[model samples]
Target: MPGTVKKDVVVGLDIGTSGIAVAVLNRSSVAIQEPLGFGFCSSMIMEKGFIGDSEAAAYNVKKALDEALTAAGVPFTTAYVNVDGPELVIRHGSVKQAITRRQVVDARDLIKLQQHLCETVLPEDVLSIIQLDNIRFYIDGEYVFKPQGCRGRELGLSSTVLAAPRRQMDLIWQCLRNAGLPPTTETVVGALAVAQGVLSGVERKLGVICVDLGAGMTKVVFINHNMLYKLSIFPAGAGNITADLAVGLHTTLEAAEKVKKEYGLGLIAGDVHVPNISGSGYNTVPGSLVHKIIKSRIEEILDFVKEFIEELDLGASLPGGIVLTGGGALLNGLTEVAQEYWLMPVRIGFNSLPGEEAPNEDAYRYTTAIGLASWGTGQVYPGMRQKAEKGFKGRIKSWFR
Candidate 1:
């Protein structure tokens, strides 16, 4: 077998419902300057957020990847991608080991604990664990960040596990294979990737929420103490808002989408001119009516988010507030509307690159994809980069087997 060459460049591919976003980043660059190039293509073959046709999805994925890589003047084979919606499953599990002998714990022990968690049995064969994230290690009932040198008689690992149902994994893998790429070292949950790219370290510790509104689904991510504490997917997103507008105003889906983008949260102070709805289908729907529709649906989604947070009993405690990303976040006035409903500080999430140069006006749309690339470059230690599952922490594999 040929040894894997260490990559100075990495790519993040977000196969989202509304579109597929690809971002190329330099592994050697500072965190803010890593963006090399990025691209997004509408996901025509993804039906309601799942891959309806593997061939079509792969083709689109390849096209997006090539577009970004070519623009950046970089080359790549395997890249990390995001997974969510139908194939997405999250659960909480804690695994503990008795040291038996009170001895110093080492890197080997931590790696073994993670592997043991991953290799542990699941409820069914259809599901496979991808990440044992947000792990907090404790030695002899005391929480510790660096447990490798600690002496302890007992060790515990607690984390939120990300798993994929077989079909979801297959669709994404097939797309990678058809793209002529190597098998991924591992996959990232879409919302988890978004958090990595958008939320700052301080925000994560202060507690925060990320609402990734894609065309097919809305991924709600809650973070506290710099880890993904909880996540859930709502079946509808900005696409559904477009659909509702189409039905309510008797306009075409395309026109409704345009209007939604142009005047989202439609809370403008004056009468707004409706474009694209002229001639036969022309009917002037008041700007207020449009905002009303958008606000209602958005509020409903916010309500669900509120309910979820309330369940965790941290709704009132998130000083960092909510960060909204994804293509849907581009909608005008969305941040204002979100703040109104959540009663917390709200901001549209955008990645900070090294310089003032903006890749595109809609850079926020690629938040998750940028994260995938950042993560590919070792934002997450080991990050499925090792050839062996048991590879030591900080050991970078030259290539994936």
Candidate 2:
């Protein structure tokens, strides 16, 4: 592979239940990126992260690409795809290597160990492996991050693999191809991407859970020590809230969606006079009613987040607390709701980008897509040098040093 240069551009494509987002970034180095263009297109082809209609999904993908490419004034290349964890079948695998002598562990040693781990036997139900990231490396039975040049008698590798049903993966590829997009580098979970873009190194080390409240599904991602710890997706999402408001308020889905955003915070903030909503059914209804509806659904979604947190006993011990991202995170007063539920510090995600309004406003909704672009463009995040290095010179330097 060639090295990333000043003009090397990457695209992140986030295919969500309610819409598709595209983010284009110009990579400067291992950690620096500048936004070129961003495009967001709404579609009804996806239902809770699953593609309900393949043809419509493909067309929507193209429209999103066109929007982004035209804005950036650049041609298409391979994109990084953001597929939430629920769409994948999760598995844990580990491998061990015996070191007869206490010698310096080099990059090749780590690579071989990872290759062994990749040989993990999959269940017959698995279709294909989407992506394998992060590893709990060990030398002489002690956990380590960069294992190179360590004098140890044994090497070990442990990691989580995200795989998907073959048909589902195929449909995604077909949609991309039909959209005239290039091949994808790897599949990334949207929550994980959001975490990378939102949480800092110290925050991850302290402990943090990033929940992406997307339209179709709510995704939970746990981060610690600057590595991906766990990821999961739930069936409930902000869309459920919209549906609830639509039914409870006796309004059209569009009207309910508008009302939800306008009055979603309820009395938690204050009342807003929505003139668009009329008739006896809504004219006298206080914003509290709308808040009541939104709160009920949001509480249920937070409960789902609680289930995953319990998996690792992340209930009350997380010092870095919880960070919210994704389109669903845009709802007013959502952070307050999350804080009340967890009894922990909660905040909405914003771009880590410096000195600019996130290369565009409304960056909160596009956090996952931006993170995906970093992966698709092979641009390393601030602390992922070990995973991004490649090529003969890079290899020789590692071995010789």
lDDT for each residue of candidate 1 in 1-401, tens digit (9 for 90 to 100) = 48643446778888877778888877765444466777778776765446888998888988988888887886765477787874577777777887644477866677777766654534555765555577678888888877877898888887676777766666666777787665544577878888888888899898999888777778888888777778888887888899888877777788888888888875666654444444364667778888888888888788887777787787367888898887778878888877877788888887866233335666666788888777755443454323334242212112231
Quantify all predictions' global Cα lDDT against the true fold. Answer: 0.73, 0.70
**Residue 327 lDDT, candidate 1, scale 0-100:** 72
Report the C-alpha displacement of residue 282, candidate 1, in angstroms.
2.6
Assess the local accuracy of residue 286 in candidate 1 as a C-alpha lDDT between 0 and 100: 76
In TM-score terms, which candidate is top?
A: 1
Task: Name the candidate that leads on lDDT.
Answer: 1
TM-score to true structure, per model = 0.82, 0.79
User: Candidate 2 regions off by >4 Å?
Assistant: 1-5, 29-31, 85-87, 97-116, 119-121, 136-155, 268-288, 352-361, 376-401
Model 2: per-residue lDDT, tens digit, 1-401? 47635466777888887788888887744567778787778887876556777888888888887887787787644567776536566778888898644577876777666545645534444355555677678987899866777888898878876666766666666676667665334567677777777777788898888888888888888888766778788888888898897777666688788887876664744543433334434433556778888889988898888777778876468988888887788888878877887778888776754225334545665677888876544332222332422222221111112
**lDDT, candidate 1, at 3:** 67
